[model samples]
Target chain A: MDIPSHITIKEVGPRDGLQNEKVILSTKEKIAWINRLSQTGLSYIEVTSFVPAKWIPALADALEVASTIERKKGVTYAALVPNIYGLERALQANIDEINVFVSSSETHNKRNVNKSISDTLDVIKEVADQSLFTGRKVRGYVSTIFGCPYEGKINLDKIKKIIDSLLNMGIYEISLGDTIGIANPLQVEHTLEELKKSFPLSIFAMHFHNTYGRGLANILVSLQQGITTYDSSFGGLGGCPYAAGASGNVATNDLVNMLHTMHVQTGIDERALTLARRIIDDKLGKRFSSHLLQIKNEQVKK
Target chain B: MDIPSHITIKEVGPRDGLQNEKVILSTKEKIAWINRLSQTGLSYIEVTSFVPAKWIPALADALEVASTIERKKGVTYAALVPNIYGLERALQANIDEINVFVSSSETHNKRNVNKSISDTLDVIKEVADQSLFTGRKVRGYVSTIFGCPYEGKINLDKIKKIIDSLLNMGIYEISLGDTIGIANPLQVEHTLEELKKSFPLSIFAMHFHNTYGRGLANILVSLQQGITTYDSSFGGLGGCPYAAGASGNVATNDLVNMLHTMHVQTGIDERALTLARRIIDDKLGKRFSSHLLQIKNEQVKK
Candidate 1:
């Protein structure tokens, strides 16, 4: 029952959401969407990923997207950078923050980045060093933190080691991802309790997918555990390519609606977020995984 | 988190689910589906409603459905009975339990039953008297306990009064319903805290809609408040006819999945439940509001 008065919501629709979508929006479209999100009072947005186009063709225009969007005064525009090469592109785009990712599961990390966990960390170390030297903050993402598609249950000791490495590398915050959306509230409470024993709870962020519809419940337990920051996509737009049967990230619209209803402020306007969702819905021409968006669609039809 | 080790799940798919669905299953289909559910280890199943066919044509075969379904040992087959007339029909069908419903919001009650709250309660009192005289247990449903469509925020005092009246009328347990699916965890905690002051928490059940995707989160908070019983539908069927934008009831599949993962036993078999869902899906031939079913569908497509 002890909930925070305010929460930090990191908008990841432009980057993670678009990357997994089948339809690739044009550079102009991406910029317009991000610009719309900027005006919604969101203080942080992961705009694009600087991965090679060959890896993620959907976000191929990352540099253009990061460079052209209208940046709000307090909003930190971040882009995911895999290594020094991607970091160079992000720096050239004048990104406000840098993000690096590695999977806690070995098989998932290899499938995601075509490298071992240690190798991925070695590369991230260089990226983090350069991004810090350039006066840009860095955030880390640990995917498959809850469970892995290939590996059933992950070893908590391995997750602790990966988090330790990311924190030591100057990554201010680590977003723990339920890549396949298989986390439950009991597991969330137990995991957070263990993680808090080693690190400050503030450095942890929850990135849940609504695949099995337990995302909000897990987030509720996270709130009770005193973790505040959350990463979500507008219209519930992202999924893990490596994980079959996985749905999209927890929709920002649904997350914000629940948070605001609980009197926990996210500083995001619901109507403005709906405007941004409309753009994505128009381009996709499909139903989203978001409950709020689906309900609104039903209302419009009526 | 003080979660209970065992919980009771009341499956209301056959009655509430089909009542809101556009497709109407034949008596044979309903019997077959309910038979499948009886095999799923679920102890309580609201098989059908005895209201007039003119009102809910989708479940017009309530008499045959309640009579024909295979009654497994340890299963309580229940049906909704609005008044003495419906109670007579349910009694003729030999239903194990009777359920009566009234909305907390006067407008919703008028719209739903063409009667005021007090008049509806009077009708329920008569039905409860008849059912109890016949050696049958009766359960009460208080709709729009969280919020109402026409009345906006319903007064909590009105809800407490309705619950008080139902309990006084020999209703064994009262199910508090979020008719519009607009409830949040904080609101759930606050409301449950207030209700517990006047009644034992064991006498209350949580019936939530997944309209805003806050169903499971609300259930989580209810668990923390020591409320053990929940009402859900297979494949997430049922929406409020009076609420314009409300979605279906929380999917029993999703609810059981989370409960089983949390080690809270529900005495239900997941695979057996999927068999029941398959029958509904085939008869309806449309997508359901269940997260687990949707993910399974994607896997089938793959």
Candidate 2:
């Protein structure tokens, strides 16, 4: 199996992770965490989401958080935008990239955004076009690409159509998410084998959840398929609010540790990433899930 | 990657898991756990270790645990035997198999058993000869085959020598262990690729720790290399007492989940395995570190 010499890791801790948590970090705390993440040699950081405050109080301070953090020289600071209103807010905050999300499963799409798949696609098409006109890169996220909590196995043809539509609308990158963390290696191989046939590897990334401990194994399969970009949360901070038993995104430290150990260079400062995880974990008054952080905690006890 | 159609899972929770815990279960508790494990369709279960009570107070009732459990028709009840004395005790308990372990790294060997590698080899040879005559299957475990806690990376030559010694002793299976949980897929591939040239696939198994969260990934690499049998603990119990933050063996549920999801038949009932995990977790008054168990807990909360 061929493995890449280098891979790209996008940190989504501030957005995806904190949104699912009960405790809310203050605007200052959010900026501090994002600022810390910027120094970790990561190319992209999904700083926050621009959804309505009433809908998600956890990320209500997204505007202030987006404007305050001192942007790093080489890092791209991005934000999740739900619709034209959220995209407008993100544009006001000067987000480097606008990320639009939709789920392949109809049940998940209706529950997550209260819209049908076609409506969500229309929004994505409109947002991507607007973002491109505003001189910003647009990233598309297809959630529940592997399996859905309500609908079970997602149709591969549906996912392919979504990807084709997103790519045609000037979306620069597309991240396929296993929202409920039900992906297996063979399932990943099957999905990618078919997906790669219609698209090049350059526009694709993987965002896996570690709810069932299949995150790294799925990543291994994807790496062999030559997809290099991965989206992760520091400290493994997010869980699906809709899916019971679904845990956080794969931890950035754990992902980097495996990548570096396998000689797949990620250019991340391991120490800096841990410090970033610690800052948010301490504020949340809990130790978030992370294999590297857990080991570090043990070392401290020793 | 060539994935196996079937894999062997040897449950080591009853022995290796409880041995490293702070709380010792009562003899009755141990018996109950083992009995529950037997109904889980597992073909092999390491019920207890035959070391003296002073060495492992947690499993002091190994003899009682061994004598009481109702063995399933096809299950092989095994125990960890330290030497001739431990093997003799195991023989008295009518263990279906006897397992002997030694570390590949000299520093780990000296710390773990207070014996030199050559001294340990002599004991294994003598014990294997005795066990063969008694008509019990002999399994050899080579710990720290990938990396060591004391010595960073173990020498491949040293591991080859250990395998040769174990094979010469008439041991039927040699389980390569990642004692410190520091194994990466590339490291596993590197070691297994070299080891496979000399040994047939039938004689090798993998014992990985989830300490750094690379357990499943390492297992994936090994499966691709055509190694089938795996050693795992229920609820991912059994941490490295010497190595800080070293979690227990990979959880049997997580292993089965990945294997079954990949269409690799392991003949294990998923619900039965979780029931086994619950019995131990409730008795210990703490949840162990299996990703699958943790998710199940979340589901129960909901």
Candidate 3:
């Protein structure tokens, strides 16, 4: 099957990958990494999240990083915003796009931002309103779409309602997130089949973790159902702080490699991404959760 | 999907899993594990291969193990027979089923079994005929179905020819083996689509490895396509000897867990399989390659 000509790689390395790192980078370091990723040809890079510094100390410098990071031509630097406060702060930072996240699992949403599913959606409405007023792009994320750690099977009706509400409020795109990576291909297909029947393929993207080792496979199923955009972290960075026993996001380089071999152009160079991974690994002083990073690192050593 | 009533968990742990272990198990230990696995409710157990003793000393006791091991009720104990000679030896041990494997990659075929693809098929024809004459079932394995470590991408036509040849020679089931474990859902779908054109879904089985972490995803894709029979090793114990970079097979307990959650029946007990893994790990002095195994091991310690 001929997949779409272009697939968008929304880089979550700066925000998602960095937030999970024990050694939090300075705002300047995060900005530099974002700029470097821009040069490496990523169209979208999520700079940081505007959550409480007390909750996510790594992104304590989110505002500074968002404001200061140089926006390259054609690069869409996005940031995660929890509510109207985070949204207003993001708007002030002049990001190209803004991301608002809620959980598909009720338990996850309750644990994540200390709000119920309804409460979180109520707040995100304000963010949507703010986006509409300012003419800024608002993207919605439904995390824990597959299996939730606390509640094993997530209600797909809830996922659909959240997506419908987000789409109804005029969100540009919605990402279906498998928060803990417990998703297999069938789950991905089963969820996507139901979602595709309702949502247009253009408005739906996928976010997957490799915790249970089905990240790329899940991506493939989504792609088959005509999904062309995805959110991934470089070196498999980023995890859910609220979800128990979650690992990093699906690796950007690994997805790039698979898509490239399938002749699906992802725009970002695999070699360049691998090089960036090497630089990141050296800076981090340990291995990332990515196989592509390790493979690239060994090739560099040789 | 009303998948096969019993998702036959072919415990390849004995042959497929142990062949890659750093330390070779004595005949007694390997036999003991196989025996214990038999008691744990696996329907199909690939005990060992009847290949050369010098080549695979890890399973040099293939004949003895097959002949002597306590054959449990409902367990179809099989052996890997490379050629007519190996099949003769398997016959000597009175294996219930005989499995013959061929790679879709010509390059891998030459390097792996020291024969060209066509030559390998010619040899298996003799084995298939002998097995058929004796009323012993013959299972065909067209391995590297997803991608090959040595040769890289494998073509669907190559896979088709191998499977068609095996079917023509009276093989009962054809297993599509992802030897390298690099298959994504899209590729698996594409391959299955092509295979289904020639063969009915009922006689097809899936064998997956988790090397690049796509094992379960591929299986899910297969399951959606109405595939019922799956071959998984206990504790995810198998690695490829010919395909060096491939990871262990999809864990039996993990497979059963995912299937059970999806409301599919495998007729296998995940808890008993978990316990069997403990027995294997205690004897082997190493952790098994399973998410449940690692998690349960820690839980037991606590």
Tens digit per residue, CA lDDT, model 1, A212-254: 8889999999999998899999888876675555558999999
lDDT of 3 by residue, A1-302 (tens): 54676799999888878887776766666777777788778999888999988888889888899999888999888899998888878888987788999987888789898899999999999888888788888999888888787887888787889989998888989988877777776677787878778877789888887765567767877877789999998877765454433447898877887787567888887767766654455566343656555444544566
Clashes of each: 0, 2, 2
lDDT of 2: 0.87
Provide the lDDT at A257 for model 1.
96
> Which runs of model 1 end up more than 4 angstroms from their true locations?
A242-245, B242-246
Candidate 2: where are CA atoms >4 Å away? A243-245
DockQ ranking of the models:
2, 1, 3
lDDT of each: 0.89, 0.87, 0.78
What pairs collide in candidate 3?
B17-B237, B17-B238
Tens-place lDDT per residue, model 2, A4-30, is 889999999889998888778888888
TM-score, candidate 3, is: 0.85
- Interface RMSD values for the candidates, listed in order? 2.0, 1.8, 4.1
Give one digit per residue, the lDDT tens place, for model 2 in B1-302: 47889999999988878898777888988888888999999999999998888889998888888988898899999999989999888888899999999999998899878999999999888889999998888999999887787788888887898999899888999998888788899888888888878888789999998888889999999999988899999888888776666668988989999999888999999988887765666666354778888777767767
For model 1 chain B, where is the 10-residue window of minimal lDDT?
Answer: B238-247
Winner on DockQ (1 vs 3):
1
Docking quality level of the chain pair in candidate 2: medium
